[model samples]
Target: MRPRSLDEFAGQEHVVGEGSVLRRALDAGEVPSLILWGPPGSGKTTLAQLLSAQVGAAFEPVSATSAGVADLRRAVERARVRSRSSDTRTVLFIDEIHRFNKTQQDAVLPQVENGVVTLIGATTENPSFEVNSALLSRSRVVRLEALGDMQISALLDRALADTDRGLGSRAVELEDAARRRLIELSGGDARVALNALELAVMATSDTNGSARVGPEDIEGALQQPALLYDRAGDQHYWLISAFIKSVRDSDPDAAVYWLARMLEAGEDPMFVARRMVILAAEDVGIADPQALAVAVAAQQAAHFVGMPEGYLPLTEAALYLAVAPKSNSALRAYAAARADVAATLNQPVPLHLRNAVTSMERAMQFGAGYRYAHDQEGGLIEQQHLPDGLTGRRYYEPTDHGAEAAIADRLRAMRGVSPRVSYRDTPRPMIGSKRPRGQAFGDRTLHFEPHVPLIGGRRPNTSRSCGAGSPIPR
Candidate 1:
């Protein structure tokens, strides 16, 4: 049953309760154009009607989905006429106001500005993103929270006992478990609970006089099942996090299930697809080079194909990523490089590495003796490109996982020589043992502070030096 008066309105005490701004405005009998933003069944429509009645204005309801610019013009004209004839203003309540395109929404501005009608718009989406800025600026956006369990239960109790507008005529009684199930399945949605309750009572034959409804009957009435997901609330973030984590953990089943849950909850499939793409780069990485490509392709397909068929590519990409070889080496490598850049800011480029573009630059030997690697045997030669004081610094550490293993081998060959020290093979330092002395090496020896705290700190017990014959320092 719809609430005819604010006193009978269930929940949303913050806005319509005693001494609230809206309540005070209602008392003043000069309510301003306002926007009610909340999830479905959060009493936006009912609130609009109650407010119109409170202000003693003619109520004109329009659905933005069906109403066009023409409808707005007609409503405004009617309001203007009513204002002149009866000296009564209109309160135009546009449901799903966000559905109105910018042009259509703009059509209501003049009337709203002139007070022909107090625009009471209702939206499930954020007004800032949906409603025109001009209209939004003139209205106070009041946020209504989803009805809690206790509130929904109280509403159900009222609906069951109220003979005037509820199912009291049928003399229906709901089992305790059935009531709890209804509340849970409704997901804090009042309309859903009421509709389900009405259906269950109507579907079941009254036993002698009172029809006894159980969870089974309630479940049957709710044909379109839904999880307790608030797209604009915290559950939205939690669900997406769970989905990404499932994909990262390489659990195809969990990933697919979460993806389905989000899709069913009306989450933008494109949003989910975009997250999968990030997961491909961050978690899957070069271990499966195709993962990123598949994720990007899925995102593009979702946009191009749109819903229903779009879900196929989205799900396929999720599954592909979940089963692909996982690696965070690329992410770690980049982080390391970034850390070095931050720590050693403004290090000068080595003379050999600088481009010898001008005569003076060539005289300063910016690119002197720069070897042409392609001209050398096997198109490889030993050369240091890092700036001075940072020679032999290593950032990208290829993992032994999947495709990276081959990359590691290729990288080792291109680099001319590998660090001979085995960090894992080194024994742990004994208590009270001395810090190991730096071993002798050629001019290529790269000394690093023993406690310099490198990014991820160079695999436990590893030596920091990156030249040949470097020992695994204790």
Candidate 2:
């Protein structure tokens, strides 16, 4: 049975209540171009259908899976003709609107802007990423939430007794506990609730002239194979969530345990492992640079090994990722640097830093001020190397933790002296390749300049160079 009006719509009162944007739009008897974003079976299509009924507008529907730019063009042309013939506006409902690529989205933008068809696009994905800015700019995004336990309960209650639209006359009685089971199984998805209800009702045999559907009956009615994830049931999202949170919480033991649950369910180890890798970086950064390396290695190991066996490396890596001291400073630094570069896109490089690989290039301004650091006292010098406006711009701010402290110390010193100057004034270069073993740069300074004279008659230079080349400055 068709729901007569918005009042018949269940849940999401926050969006469908009086004065709510959607509520007001429907009451105004006009629905503009809009995107309804939410999870599956949240009544997006139903809302579109209701909009057509309530506003007395003709509705046209298309699936993005099959609809292309040409398909959208045709729909718009048909809508235009329909308005001309029936003197009525048409609303084009696109399910999975996020599936539309840029060109497909662009094709529909003009019509939506010109009001040729009031577009009602629906998507389960984040529309901000899938929808182009221009299309999104012209559409108001309406969010739909999953049905709550109470709402789902009410839906099941209605389904059990509504004679016209439900299987009430079929001699079936749903136990309260069983009803709760169905509600839990539905995962706030109404369609799933109805489908499960249908299965349970159909399975019920007449008990004393009235079929009594108990928890067992309902359980028996469920799909025999059991869905990989009960999209509507309790087991679907809960485990995935637990798995991710376990990794984030840094309980390697818990992380591995949850991972086992997913893997046992035939979950994609690569998907699970990929997320672990992200957690490794996003949740565990410079505090343990090895965490990311471990994660990457595990991903490759998992990919090559595949599941069952591949899960071993994944478990080991997950443990390391969970145990690693957490830090996001490096990730943040990269983001800051990226933001700076984008703001100054196409900025010209300084002439001195430009490559002078060709003989002619060296004659132009290329490498004009470039220096060789190896020629200096401690392989140190000062010079400008970045673009004119962005020289010495601090992008990566290392955190003083883990092995990163060494990096911070080195950066501290390098910051004081320009890299270009180090390259120029140094007795050596940045080293076209890794320096030979034991061939270190800088003064091996175990000897102090008598910052404080020895209180006791001790060796003045207690520290001695281990080899011919040492990093310590004399």
Candidate 3:
């Protein structure tokens, strides 16, 4: 049953609750051209109708799927005539407004500008991307949230008791279990809940002048729950973000749960695999160096085997990453280096560090004082490898986690710096103890940088090769 008035409307208290902006506007008979953006069955159409009636405006409804420019022009003409003759406003309600192309949307802009019709456009897509700038600027977008369980329950109760508009005439009695299951299956859509409830009552056998709806009846009526997901819409981004964050937080359970959600919802398995691959490098890093290999193997396995069997490797990779020691040192090192590259002017490699491929270059002492590590004791010697301007800058800071611990110790030894005590050797931090800020290496503080998506295919201008005399092409 549709809500006839704002009072009867459930949920979206932020939009039309008492003392709210839209509520005040509607009460003052000053309804503006609006864009209602939300999921299906969230009462976009019903709210538009109620708003039109509240202002005593002539309602002209059109579906973007079936209505074209001609239909829109006719509606505008009707609004013009009505406004001139009877001094009545017109509310042109377009459902699925995102379906309208730029040309079709443009056709209505002039009418809206002149106030021939107060447009109320509804869309399941984000208006920022789908709606054109001119029309979007003119209309105020009101976002409606999905109905919560309590709100949906209230709507069901109202439907069962109202004989005039709901299924109250049938005298249907819904079992508590059936009601809960129906609400769960509806996915916060009041229209779906009401329709399924009506179907369940109609299908169930009448007993003692009343049809009793059980869990089975409700399940049968619904058949399958329609997941609130659009592959190319917000759901895609939201689910993937949840999955990545869960893995980064080292919550294996949450990671797997999100993975299953995405996979079962028909998200491209390859996309999930690719993101996992990036996560292995960006989150797991050298803490568990094998994490990258596992992620890569999973990607290959998924591509080779294909679903539904492909989920096997995908699940294994997700678990491995979630449990692996976490480190963003690799990510941080790259970011530090990248920032320097972006900020500083191109600095040439030192003459000693450059290759002298030609006789003429050798005569100029290009390879003059470079100490080859292979000729030095222990294959390590103190030498300036970086350009003169950046002779002592350290970029790669190895964390004391997993395999990186040994690397950190080696690096300290090479740099003539004493290694700090290992964190694993010490007693673990007590539960609820304040975690040390950033990457902890005993008493030393190494700031951990947050993960940032890498922009691929960018190279520094001063990059050079050891085997060639020329600078590497950018």
* Cα lDDT of model 3 by residue, 3-53, tens digit: 888999899999999999999998898999999999999999999999999
Where's the lowest-lDDT run of ten residues in candidate 3? 465-474
Per-prediction TM-score, please? 0.67, 0.64, 0.86
Residue 49 CA displacement from its true place in model 1, Å: 0.6
Best by TM-score: 3
Candidate 2: where is the Cα deviation over 4 Å?
A: 67-78, 207-209, 224-268, 271-297, 327-474
From the highest TM-score down, the ranking of the candidates is 3, 1, 2
lDDT of 2 by residue, 1-474 (tens): 335678888888887788887778788877778899887768899988888878888889999999787888888899999988988899999999988888888888788878888889998777777788998889899889888888777777776677898766667778988888777767678788778778777667656546777877666766542333533233445776787677777777888887787777677777777887787777677778788889899999999988679989988897887777666766666665565455555667788878899989887979797787787656655567566645545546566767676565555544533222221122321223533122212342221121211212232365442222322232
Worst 10 residues of 1 by lDDT: 422-431
Model 3 misplaced stretches (Cα beyond 4 Å): 207-209, 417-474
Rank by lDDT, highest first: 3, 1, 2
TM for candidate 3 is 0.86
